[model samples]
Every structure is written in structure tokens, then in C-alpha cells.
Target: MFFLGCFATATAAAAAAEVAAPVPGYVLDNTEVREIHAASLKRDYQLYVALPDSYRASERRYPVVFVVDAGYAFPVARGIASRLHRHAGMEEAIVVGLSYAKGDEGVYSRRRDYTPSVPRNGGYRSDMPGRPAAFGEADAYGRFIATEVFPHVAAHYRADMRRKIFVGHSYGSLLGLQVLLTRPNTFEHYILGSPSLWFDRGVMFDREKAYAAAHGDMPASVFFGIGSRETLAPGKQRSRAEEDADMVADLRDFHGALAAHRYRGLATTLKVFADEDHASVFPLVLTHGLRAYLKQK
Candidate 1:
């Protein structure tokens, strides 16, 4: 009788354990939310800020990485940051994720806040168009980061000003490139993944070339990455292969422009992940980029 009771108890415990296990690849948890209106877009952003495990253990200020398109990228960033700290001897950096708010506001809000300009065709083009007038607010977004956002983060967190980085993918990368072109040193480092270079007829690449021609010296560290499968997405009114080829060509031109600057102070790296697609490549990018970025420190 006692053996039967013990067996029943073990069975129930095993069932409980199975029920309590977390789903695979489920890493994010709802922590906090904040609203910031900048770049002329009313944004209710979901913020996922992760500190190093040793942050509180030892009072130390670390670098910060601002992540755009946080909905999909934050978990990847967090995981990469933690792993890098453990295995690669990378310094712990604070991650600030910025995501669009819910409801009718989010669709148009990110597009306007992250893009450089609205194309003449009345479409953002790189991204499926949403609200037309609200597009091309990247400059204002930079202002928000430099003024409102950075100050708030600096005051609240232990962050080093000179070692900060801005990370973005797709339209977000378009904004990162815009900041690098005009602002130059807003963030000491930039991690751009799969930037939408087809937007507005590749004006961003043109701006890079013009900047290289005009400037005598440029100083910044940029890490550019693209997934091999990013070109697989079906396009509207355009051939997928043509779009991919254009994007790849523009990216190559942009990288060449940066390289052509040959400014002794400028350092940049471009990488392509052949196995991962646009949605699946960010984690690897963050891991490799962070390891490289920390090598300087």
C-alpha cells in the first residue's frame, strides 16, 4: 500500500513538473512600459532594460545599446548580451529597447519616426506605406535620442557616454545610417542590420558618398549586417530578385563609400549571415558585434 502511494505521488510530481516547464525559446517577460513622444511621433514604447548580473554586485557604469524595433529584437539582444558577458569576456552593456505602442498608432508611428524621407511616389517603398505625411522623421528621431532619451537614460542608469551604441534593423537601420551621415558622432558605435536601402531611391547611400567627398576625416565604428534570406520577401509591384539585387548593390556602395573615406579614424565592418533570414539574423549580429565592439575597451 505504501509503495502504491509513493508511485502515485511520483507520477503527480512528474506531471506537475511538466506543466510548470516554460515554453521553448520563450525568453521575454513583461517588466515595464513607458511613453515618449519624440520625432513628432506619439510613441508608447515598451522598454526592456537588462542589467548585467554583476551590475548590482559591483557598482560600475557600463556602455548602453539603444535597440530600435524592440518588439522582435529585445530578447535577442538580451540573450546575446548575457552570453557575450559570460563566454566572450565582453563588458556588460545596458540594452534599451524601443517599440511601437499598440492600436492604430503603432503602424504609422514607427515608419514616420525611423525613416529619412518619403519617396516621391507617396510611398515609403522600403516598408509598406502607412501614413504618408508622417514619414521622413529620422532627423527628429536623432534629436530625441540625443536630447530627451539619452539624458533620461544617463540620469537613471549607470551608462558611459562615450561607449554607447545605437542598434537598428531595416527602417531602424535607415535611421542609424542617417544619424551617422549628418550627426557623425551622436553615438560612438552603430550596429545596423539589414537596412532598407531601397527606400526613397537609395538617397541614404548618395548622402554617404557626398559626405565622404566633403569631409576630410570621419571617426566612428559601424557594424553592418544583412541576412542572406532577406531578399526572399515577396514585393508588391516589384520583382523580389530585383529588389534584393538593388538592396545588395546599395549596401555594397554604402560600405564602399565608408571605406573610401579612408579616414584613419574611421573603422567599419560589414557581415552577411547566409543561413539566417531578416527575422532570424539579429541575435547572431548582436553577439558578434558586441564581442568586436568590446575588444576596443
Candidate 2:
């Protein structure tokens, strides 16, 4: 009877343990978080950083890859970089995920912070529905990156300020383009995936024109990527301007425009993945973009 009682007790204990809530998992190793407040925008932001496994033992400075849309991109980039460095023979660099503004993440922060210009009549567009009514604050956000993020990163990590790489997608890529056009020196290499050139009726073209008009030379390398299925197919039952962006053509036009300038020290590459759409192109973009980053190594 005692043996049966003990067996029953043990079985109950095992079942209880199985039903217990699982412990929280910390997936990314050798990673850290840094907080920096934007004074101009009165917003708090966090930099989700992943360091190379060799970071601790080595005293050498490493170029940093800054990935925007951290909430979605951080873990992906971290895992890809680690895998590439370990098996794919790619060089390792520090990865920084630029997160959205805390407490204002979902609908407002990115629209406001990543756009280069604000539109009239509530600044909402059919192309990018569900966007906040107020946006177009990329200038201030760029300032935050330049003035605050730069200093913060420089002070804390062994980041090589001279060789910063900027990674962005859609609106994030649009912000990267804003910085690239206005100040090409901000990031030496740019991985701009599926940019929303349709934003604000191509206001960025004017910005590009402004850059070309003022500058004799642009010193930067850009990797432009898109997907074959980003455009609206006739039978897809589309709605609104979201499916009408024709992002593939936009990607080519932007690449062609950058190439046509033929500026000194400027180089660009474009890749379109078959059987993928805007939603699924980011990983390939990173894979190829990091391969392109090998030039800097």
C-alpha cells in the first residue's frame, strides 16, 4: 500500500510539473540593451544589441549594423549573423536593433519617426492605412540617431564610427534613404529592402534631387532588394492603395536613379527574389545584404 501510495504521489507530482507554467526564455546570448532618451522628441527608446561571440576577448573595434524595426527584426538578424559567422564564412560585426519608441510602438511611432516629410489633410494615405494621423518626423529621429545614438554607442561599445551599416525595410528603409540622400556619410553601407517609394507621392524624389543638385559626389554603397510578388496581380482581389504601390517598379526606378547619377564613390546593387512578397523578403535581404557587407570586412 505504501509503495502504491508513493507511486501515485510521484505520478501526481509529474503531472503537476507538466502543467506548471514554463519558464521565460532568453534566446539571444551575448546581447545587451541600451537606453537612450531623445531630448527633442521627448521619447524613450532602447537599442537591442547583439555582440559577436569574440567581442569579449578581442580588443578590436567592430563595425556596427543598425537594423530598424527591432520589434520584428532583432531576433532574426541576431540568429542570421550568428549562423553566417559560424558556418557561412561571413565576417562578424555588432548588430544593433533600433526599436520603436517605447509606449507608442504599434501605429504611431514608426509613421512619425521614419517618414521624411509630413503630408497635408491629416497625413493619412490609402497606401499606408492604419497609420497615425500625425507623422513625418524623420528629421528629428535622424537627429536623435546622429546626436544621441551615435554618442551613446561610441561611449559604451567599441563601435567603429567610420563604418556604420544601416539596415531598414519599407518605412524603415525610407528613413535610411532619407539619411542617405541628405547625409550620405551617416552609414557607409545601406541595406534598404522594399522601400515605400509611394509614400507622400514620391516626396523622396525631391529629396534625392536636392541631394544631387547640391553634391558633386556621394560616398556610399547601397543594396536595394524587393520581391517579385509585391505588385498587385489582376485576380488577387485587392483593396485600397496598399496593393497598388507597384514596389518592384519603384525599387528598380530608385536603383536606376541612383545609378544614373554616377557619383564618385557611390555603388548600388538590386536583387529581386522570386516567389516572395514584401512580407517575406526581409530575411533574404539580410542574407544577401550581409554578404554584401563582406566588402567592408
Candidate 3:
């Protein structure tokens, strides 16, 4: 939750901190970094970007992938991007790791910003009154990204907006769905890992069904994944087994609904990792999802 880097100049300081030798075949370097106080959310956020070696030599623009909850996931994503670059010479990408303000406040800040709407009578529903109070302002948050964040990154760096990809986990997953449904073309590809689909009593599934029935072709590539261990034990020991089951059920249903659409222009796949828990599956999900996206591209 610390500032990965404050200004772009800090990149050099970070690189120097790790002056020790590199690890065998692997290499490390700090790319450009930026921090912003998003007016919509009223909180500062950090972006950690990693560039491939070839990026320095080429004048060509590259695709950009926004990874939500980047405080923890950035390392995993950096590894994936490097491996793909070294082995397959895959097209380079600008990897941005999204982070909110530091400490416990960040957790609550993400919960408020990432969530869409609160359910009136659902297990996860907040005790707060009205949808806006509990779920915060999802529409405003999305607008901030579309208007402020995306444009800032595009203008400051060599990013290909046409090939934009979004990767989100849990509540961030809900934000991805909200964007996909409301602004279908915002992101060309979506990597949603362990989406909190049970939010608002499966509201996203309802939205997806309606969109499928009304629309013809949805042009997007989506990769969905959930850990095989996405469950809770039914007993006095566990907090809420029923709630866990309901969440997993909703995720599967949403996955099935997207499959049913069979939208010709849309390519989507879902994976479940037997050994992974909700928190641990992110690395694997990013690894395989990026591979799939590269292949499709």
C-alpha cells in the first residue's frame, strides 16, 4: 500500500535500490510511474508501469492493460509480461498497476469505489440506507477512468487505445462488468478473476441476460476465472457458508450466460483452479489470460 513511485523521476531511485545482481535469466527494471488524486473518488491512486526491453528501441506504440488492485498483483503481471516478451517476442504492452491510498483506508476506499450498486435484500448488502450510500458512486468512478485516467495515460505515454485491456479481481470485477455493459467498447479485452458476481443478488447476471436478448453481436474478448477452492465449510466454525456458495453459484451462472450469447465477435473462456483460493489464483489467471489475449491478437 506504499507509494510504488511518486514522480517519474523516482523510477531511477527505485532501480538503484535493487543494485544487487539479477537472478539468472530474469531481469528487473522500473518503468514510468504516476500518482493522481482522482477527484471523483477523492483519493490518491498510484500507477506502476513496466515496459519490455524492446520498448526502448521501438518507436511503435503498444497496447495497454490496466490491472486493478495493482498493489499486490503488479508483481505477478510484471512477471507475465517479461516472460512473454523474452520467450515468444509477444507484442509489448504498457502494464499499469492501479493502487489506491495506503493502509486500511485503501481497503474501504476500493470497496466504495469499485462496487456498482448495493442490493436491497442480499447477504452482502450494506446496512447503510439507499443504494448510493452503501455502493458509493460507480457511475462517477467509471466516468473518472474513462475521462481522466485513460486520457492521462494515453497522452503521456505511447499507448494504443484501440487495444485497451482491463484486468480486475473481486469488486474490481464488478467494475469491469459495469463498464462492459454500459460502455461495451471501453475495453477491447477483459480479464476478470474471481469477480464478486454475487453482489446485489446477482444483478450483473440479470443485466447480461437483458443485453444478450437485445443485442446482436458484442465485440469484445473476455477471460473469466475462479478458484476451485471458492467455497466455505458449512458449520459453526465458518462465518457464512451459504453466502460463499451463493457467490460461486452466481459466478458460474454469469459465465454460462455469456457463453449462451455465443456472440460471434466475442471470444470468452472460463477456468477454475483446483489448488487456488480466492486470493491465490490471481497470478495463474493473469498468466493464462494474457497468453490467450496474445494468441487472439
lDDT of 2 by residue, 151-205 (tens): 8898989988898988899999989998888788888999999998878777777
In model 1, the worst 10-residue window by lDDT is: 236-245
Evaluate model 3: give its lDDT: 0.75
lDDT of 1 by residue, 1-297 (tens): 999999999999999999999878644542334556553445444556777777777778889888887877776787788778787677777888877645535547677878898665563333334534568888887777887788777887788888888898888898898898888789888898888887776778678778777886667888988877665446644322335444544566788877877865678998888887767887777766777687532
Top-lDDT structure, candidate number: 2
**Model 3 alpha-carbon miss at residue 268, Å:** 1.0
Number of the top candidate by TM-score? 2
Stretches off by above 4 angstroms in model 1 are 1-34, 37-46, 101-105, 123-133, 230-245
Q: Provide TM-scores for the models.
A: 0.79, 0.87, 0.78
Question: What CA root-mean-square deviation does each model show from the true structure?
Answer: 6.3, 3.9, 10.2
Q: Which residue window of length 10 is worst by lDDT in model 3?
A: 236-245
Any runs in candidate 2 off by more than 4 Å, and if so which? 1-22, 121-132, 235-243, 295-297
